[model samples]
Target: MYRFSYSEILEDAPQLARERERMAFDRALHLLRTVEARGERGAERTAAIAFVQDLWNVLLSDLLDPENALPEALRSDLVSIGAWTMGEVGEALRAPERSLAALIEVNTSIRDGLQ
Candidate 1:
């Protein structure tokens, strides 16, 4: 018979939580970029806008909430980057090439700002 150690399970919780948050953030970012690249307009645009708005709302709230388990610096960075990415996604949906170029520029600026 195989035995499961409770200590090992407890030790893995924090790392697992971190990984889960990271994955969620990444998925949200990917969806934003996909919506931008799709050049969605009309109802699609509305849906995409709503999606990003919801994502940012949740992310910012989580970052600011005292009960959140993430590190403060990481929380702040995630909020900042999520906001910047949302803007870029909006621009891309509106203006494609120009927006894509602007996204690159904005991403670079944000990275520099974080430093």
Candidate 2:
């Protein structure tokens, strides 16, 4: 069996942050696409949406933390985006036919910013 450790892969602060954000965005993209195809119905879609919400919840928590190292302005911006994401998740859940472009664009933009 192959075992992977994040601590070993991300030994520096910069690399760690970038890789973490990239992974989070990738997860969001995957879940979003899954829900899109499933039309937001059934347990699978619900679980995917919940997972996406949890990702943003963690982002929001990190941005809100007083000990976070990010600049105030950047943290504020991310918090705002996080709030938008939470709302988007609710909207997407309510309207199964809604476009996931917004969610995908947000994740992609944030992921790119980390690079």
Q: Pick the candidate with the highest TM-score.
A: 2
TM-scores, each model vs. reference: 0.47, 0.79
lDDT of 1: 0.56
Q: State the RMSD for candidate 1.
A: 8.1
Q: What is candidate 1's TM-score against the reference?
A: 0.47
Compared with the true structure, the alpha-carbon lDDT of candidate 2 equals 0.78
Full-model lDDT for every candidate: 0.56, 0.78
In model 1, the runs with Cα more than 4 Å from the true position are 1-38, 86-115
- Summarize candidate 1's per-residue lDDT along 29-90 as a digit string, tens digits: 45545656785545655564565566566557656767666588888877787777777666
The prediction achieving the highest lDDT against the true structure is: 2
lDDT of 2 by residue, 3-91 (tens): 54333333456677578778888887888787776666767676777887998887787678776677899999999998998999899
Q: Model 2 shows how many backbone clashes?
A: 0
